[model samples]
Target: MTPRSVPHPRGVRLVEGGADVAVYTESAEAVEFCRFDSDGNEHRTRLDQRTGHTFHGFVPDVEVGTRYGLRVHGPWDPANGLRFNPNKLLLDPYATAVEGGYDWGQPVFGHDMNNPDQLDESDSAGSVPRCVVTDRHSFDWGDDRPPRTPLAETIVYETHVKGFTQRFPGIDESLRGTYAGLAQPAAIEYLTDLGVTAVELLPVHQFVQDSHLGEKGLRNYWGYNSIGFLAPHNEYAAGGDGGQQVDEFKALVKALHAAGLEVILDVVYNHTAEGNHMGPTLALKGIDNASYYRLVPDDRAHYFDTTGTGNSLNVGHPAALTLIMDSLRYWVTEMHVDGFRFDLATTLTRQGGDADVHSAFLDLVAQDPTLAPIKMIAEPWDTAGYQVGGFPAEWSEWNGKFRDDVRDFWRSADSVLGTVSQRILGSPDVYEPTRRSPLCSVNFITAHDGFTLADLTSYDQKHNEANGEDNNDGESDNRSSNNGAEGPTDDPEINDRRNRQRRNFLATLLLSAGVPMILGGDEMGRTQGGNNNAYCQDDEISWFDWDAADQGLQEFTRMLIRLRRREPALRPEWYRRGPRDRSTPDRVQILRSDAKGFDPPDWNNPTARTITFVFHHDDADSFALLLNAAENGVEFTVPKAPGQEWRLELSSDDAQRVEGKVTTLILEGRSFTLLRSVTRKDVRGWARAHGYEVSSKGKVPRQVQQAFDDAHR
Candidate 1:
């Protein structure tokens, strides 16, 4: 846990206890200490150059506002994640902030051979950019109360900082598309209105556009490739000196907190901006390639490449672990971030460069009280290894299975026998174990890397021609059915079906017991235009179009979220039976569509497409949610209770208002609805869901039909 800073030989010439901070250059041809002030003027930092290009020193006057850059003395090594050119300045990964967006040129490019094995060809770093010091943080938040909303009650809204605020008319146009923009009154109003408790911003860490992307006149829009864990991306800041980015980000966090919203950052620790072994080397590679990266143990030149991002962070190293831990703590204590959702988090669970599910990082997080209170979410998988349900207890994980099941269920026209019930009820099969609460599964259908919810139901295949990469990069197996069309359509039949499917999926997402994550702009029906891998487009293709807002979809989304909050049954934290369990033969009943006297309906019966859940809760009885995904509605009889008369509650058929405590007759085909009663009553504790027997090896028991039939009265 102690931070260990490795010494660079002849690096920084410590002048009387290192004035504030110092930079050491051991291997640049010529060293230059160009210092800039907050006003971008020529600020001076004294330099002491050791013979052989070691320009190491400190600026006596270099305090928080001191902005300085160092020119190093090494030939650029382009392929090994090191781009050390004595002439070109490099951004400090540890710098607190940065200002101004990057416009690529010879000054920013490395001159070493594109292949590291090849000799140097040109001087590429004469004018490369530099990061600066910052002291812009200002807040009087003493004993600031974090929202303290439990994981069970947290509904995360995964969004892009710029995209969320870019189109809002209320955010000042100048502040639009910046970190401060997210804290705008208009944006806060919208998020609060939607009942979102947390906002998970796509990676805010400083990053560089991929070289290939730059070659193609593209920019890294999503910000996944990180260069700075401690510093905020300069592009995201409205305006600042090189060091105020982090403070500005904290200001945004504070503003969000004021709105009762928690900010969970999307962190990418799996890899750096450095791509595979062939990437330009900056700090890690230059400092110690063998130490900072997870190199192939036996084959030093090669790497495991678990994350597609090339050079995976050598998380097994104590120094690397310390860096990550320190960064996380700083965000929590300094920035006041509510949580982190690690991208490609599985890579962190490897020790000694091998992917071990219960590695040291995972162990530390599981036991670290300081880090545990905040939300610890993992994407749960990477390209090389996907350990779904792999991390230790207390860590909520993104359930990819939840996404797939929900998508297939709504999009599946043919018989997907047991998908609807499984997904609608918190995906118990995936998260219910070892007392792991239902909220453990972060249920999300569409995320930043995919088509939006609207597009998922509209585009069966991706349309990524604009990427200019031959459309071969993104995923092809999208479990989407476009209602018999490729993209856009005018046919009312298919369009209506797509709209209804959207509503159903949204409702199911909010009502399900798991923690729901609404992909940003999904409520407004945002679309990637079928481009799933839009990492390289910082244009309109990746930006959320505010002019194209779907008011109806947004309102539909609002009602679904409101209903989820209103009904406690919809958000049960745990399904384990409790003392006040509502189970009674007189008041509660689970009847199969064609069964008599509470007998299990013939589940294998494809024709029997509808199952009526007849039950009651406090406030009223006679509540039923009839599900019929088939073409024709079937008349299923509900055995009359001796003293209880059935009154109409709500049905999916009534597109207007189909909720509350009331009774109803048969539900319609290809639809699901909920009904309620005027009088309070007890409901069935156990549902007619596919029951599981305790199978060996901690796996869910197969959905046995006989066990269900035995529950019949």
Candidate 2:
């Protein structure tokens, strides 16, 4: 007999005269609700467990400031990812605010791991932080229009949340390093002043610390690990009064939008911070691990280990996909976020059937009219599956080739000029015919994973000692070259060269034919103390130093961004294919410093040091850029054309080295030149810098002088 009725516990689904907010619990052998009061007073409510539980009745009069938590019960299985102990007290996965910090006690880790399932029966009672209830709603957001900045026009600044403002003097002490800090007039002004069109935040979702990092007295600095999809990291929001993180974050977004900037989140849907099969049994694992994660292909005993953190999310499952899609929609529709940069996106497209490039996950996102209109970016690669330009249309991917080629040209380009040409034109060979637009490629030199522009010119190899991994971590071959020294010095010659190289790289980025992304602090010269993977340090080493600037760098950065916004050609869309479309050549023209016009460059050309490329925009518009990366100057000549005079607007050889904005005469030598257009008998500045040389019949000399005169225009 079913024992007439097993004494059912008392419960409440709708708090008497309360609001619509409700919480649910999956298992309920033991569950209860506790409300905290300001005067240290507390209220208790019993929830029925015998009948099982999924939701807690909504309580009223509970506005913005509400604190509550749950008590649960279950076996504390460790190896199996099941850590349910009612005594320890757990935070709600949907929690917006949390009380207390990681106590670092044994309770923090689900299982003793060492104790083994054969040993400890300890409940780890009285430990673990509790979740706080948050009553979030709409904001006034007047005229809070998203920048709606075109992907092609965006220059992203990837940065850590806390590190960005904690030391910023302009932000209030309490607000510094908080979502509120990012919204302060000062923070908003800094972004606009610096000219970054979008701020690609690392991650905002609540996440767990890497067990290794936790034991080592460190924490995950980069927020790549995620726990709850809808919940924001409480640590990232300031003035944590009654779980106000949601409001604070929304406020920050509104402020950024008001400043004419967009917010692009670096989202990690690839995996959860919950590690692999041997990891802790958090919400998902506790609910249904087999369903939420891709169990190692055909091996049911293991999880797909593509995320490096140990497990890959199974987007193939509807519930899992719902979680991700819901989170994305909430951020876009509810929070009004501008876009997302999917980390290790290739992993998301892998299907058990075919792993089609046009997978279901992508198909859904692309078809969603509302979501499709937003800026969609993809990291596009990962360790398990690296797909460079393989993502479908309606998305822009980080062009690793752009990073590599640009790095080579300036660092090792002296020896590999051919590779440089392929990159400057948007890596069309790799991304074209996919029918993807040119803007689909996000070109960058230094990102958060590699050395900053400053370090690229300062350190030839990664100095990852600060990462506590002894120099074994990070990329071994960065294709980087320090003009002379290793890190820093007072050697004026080397420093000058390094600074010039930085200028060259930045200029090239703005001039390229793809969406450009500028790593944060690359402008003010931020360093990770040579720690390329400083994802564990939350100190000054990762922060953008507010004091390091010499005026020259700042002006140069600002002017470049403004000019980038000026030219339509620089921000060209995908090359639409048609009869009118320019049939791109396999290898086009590369004008040598001494050459007159376009011709194929010889890799065996032992004497060649500088090569200027003239990108022909299908008989419509063409701009020629000269790069004399050699230590000394090269006497470049303007090739014979319609004698069109090439007017030089920007040059690195300017006496002031003023960048960003300029209106000056054409300069020469030891300089990189950007010329607009030219006319008949108009030479693109050739001989004057090297001084005049004797010519045959005096025509050649005069011709060179004519080039110089054109250059001076």
Candidate 3:
């Protein structure tokens, strides 16, 4: 009987009585399909089927649990970027699920370390992980649908799947640090109650732990070093026995969707785990090194590294481009993901060794039907270059400018008020020309890479001594203030100031115009002991400290998110400027401390520290935000509303609500105030309910007002 074959869908697809496997390799002289038995016995079978640059074969009685790998026999010349060694078993680039762990002790490199000119003769089959054939249709995804939360309404919570739940007391011990743990009822409830529409999970792809980090007894806690693009990390699956990782991941997605929360994956398409020329022979490097990686024109042996990862993926090549798109589509269609956040996304847009706005990769992604609609976010810059505010209109960018300016403003850096104002208004200075909405800026104060929110307030210097690089591995210039004391302090005043600063950061992020992304564990005041870069610390250093969480801060963060959701003036869909319309009070006006009007001198004043953001909404109710960044308390005259009176809604200083017309309000230095304006009827009712003698038009008697003010003070 003739062997059946297909070339369109490239992975190992299970059929009625057999499996159809297809792989692409442009430079392979011969491609051999290898199978592993229960006892790890190798069975070699030559692929007789062939299409243009793709090898397809149909094997009979290929069971679902079959473990397999591919061997590409090609040139051994590394100088010309043709590194193909059949001795080292290569993982299937399109493997949906991978089995076993890679051992770094074994010779996994194509070229011998002792002799770089000679090929490595050692067989790496035992050390290398094999791809497991899985039944894609096995998981019963009953009524699982992406939340499809509007971008304008999205509140992203960036978290690591393992680090998020590794020490979670609410989850079962057996399921901790796994996908199941993240989908636990307790976890879902926490996220849902926090009012975040989506959870942007750190990479869950099957990645290779760095050999050097392993030697140092530290692992890659952050899953950025990926080897298998299409496979879920089996180590993250609670039920690891048999090929249940795929299903476990699917179930996690299903559970998140069921709870009305979207899952956005932080995908690393910029580079692979395979390091430079001396790197191990994994999947892409071993199969087709030159085609998959961006090689140096002068020296093909070396790679053009843009991600600070040894080798960058050549998105300029069609094969590599298709693989990225295929993997993304697989996650969306098969695994049921809502969106993606591209790591080192600027590297993917490089064409001719320069980042381009209209690069081939971006154009392809914009044109692709499967990917255009989903939420796409870009880290927007690579290690080589900074491309903030440089992404296209279709995508949202992680606003590095917003992060820096917010940190600087809170740290009392001079000349930052203007920049912070621009950032809070969704960075119209950056995205206005593109005609993108405020959602184009993904505003975040702290992210996974830098210091956690708690640490940002506690440490001014990075203490990465445990990472074994003499405190040189992480970033310097942390843009943080220790508030008169380094690390934890016993002084009550210092601690209070630190806590207030943290609240200020959270309020600023959540109350900003663009989409807000809270770093996981920040709400609970999780700290990394000043280790800003804890990428290699897989132990307690990186895990979420559930035992020592600040419950007050958590509740405060929840309240902030709730307020952001409740107030439309906080999360405006469009960029707020002069006014939307005169008929309805749809205007965003910036006023001086006197609340008169915007003056050039007042805005240009270098010593100025207070401004009022009056958000005149279409509804009768409006919001007046007063931000005071001075060291001394400032008196801000409330901006006159057309027909409504200002009522104290919320204050970062923990001030009590004092309703009625707020002619002049006192805002503490380095504090924020949120006031809501109410109508005549509501003000009168509030005044009456508070035991104040109110006139017919809601104006309280002079003595009654004085009593209320004294009581609040």
Ranking by TM-score: 3, 2, 1
The root-mean-square deviation over C-alpha atoms between each candidate and the true structure, in angstroms, is: 9.5, 7.9, 3.6
- Candidate 1 achieves a global lDDT of 0.65
On residues 1-713, what C-alpha lDDT tens digit does candidate 1 reach at each position? Answer: 21222233222222343343334333344445556655656544435534332244444555555555554445544344334554344555455665444444443434434544543434333334456555534555655667867887888999888877776788898988898888777888889999889999999887776767878888788998887787778887876545556666877887888888999999998888766655664455544455567876666666668887777888887656766876787688778898999999988987665567679888877777778789999988887777666666688899887888667665544444455455555665665655466777899988988788888878888888888889988888558767668777899877776776676667668766679999988888887888888878777877788888889888877877776666655566665332245463332344565534333335444444455544433343344455565655555554453222343333335443422222334544455665443221122212223333343333222343223223431
Model 3 TM-score, 2 decimals: 0.94
Candidate with more favorable, higher TM-score: 1 or 3: 3
Q: Could you give candidate 3's per-residue lDDT for residues 516-546 as a string of tens digits?
A: 9999999999999999999999988889998
lDDT by residue (tens digit), candidate 2, 102-199: 44456544555664343233433234444565554556667788888877778888777888887888988888888998888988887888788999
Using TM-score as the measure, which candidate wins?
A: 3
lDDT of 2: 0.67
Residue 609 error for model 1, in Å? 5.5
How many residue-pair clashes does candidate 1 contain?
A: 31
lDDT of each: 0.65, 0.67, 0.85
**Candidates sorted on lDDT, descending:** 3, 2, 1
User: After superposing candidate 2, which stretches have Cα over 4 Å from the reference?
Assistant: 1-65, 68-91, 115-126, 297-301, 353-355, 413-415, 575-609, 615-622, 639-644, 654-671, 678-713
